[model samples]
Target: MSTQQFAGANDRFLRRYEYDDSWIVAADLGVADDAVDVDVVGTTAIVVVDTGDGVAETEFELPGTDADVAVQNGVLTITVAK
Candidate 1:
């Protein structure tokens, strides 16, 4: 398992876990699911979240180029192909 925490404008954190054929990246952002947006460029994943007060953005390296993103219960989950 790989874990990383980013300190920026807001309290944001990222966690990654290695699986058999894929990697799981999770971000804990206490916001609505519709307020989170994710985009992938090359091996990097860019995450943008609307925090009501303002917008917070962060980018991190992904294990692979292809990624699937989802948000649930204020948690952002991403699965990358490896």
Candidate 2:
């Protein structure tokens, strides 16, 4: 999944990336390429930014108000708060 928008004058360039969770993981070993990290902390739900690092530290969690969700450096982090 990806999206693009042109805020510049002529949109001389293209900005695109992929976004999907069909088969994803979440976690971190250290500072990721994007400089942030996020994980569900208990299960296997994790969201990464730009590390090319792989899903070894990620966890899983349901998305809801009780989801201790957070973001750092560009990654979405989910924790067990409820």
Per lDDT, the best of the predicted structures is 1
Encode model 1's per-residue lDDT on 10-75: one tens digit a residue. Answer: 556667788778888887888899998888898988888888999978788888988888899999
Give per-residue CA lDDT, model 2, range 3-67, as digits (tens).
44233233322232324532222232234445545554444455544446543342333433334
TM-score of 1: 0.83
Q: Candidate 2, overall lDDT?
A: 0.39
Cα-based lDDT at residue 82, candidate 1: 84
The regions of model 2 sitting more than 4 angstroms off are 1-28, 37-44, 52-59, 62-65, 71-77
Q: For candidate 1, what is the lDDT?
A: 0.83
**RMSD from true fold, candidate 2:** 12.3
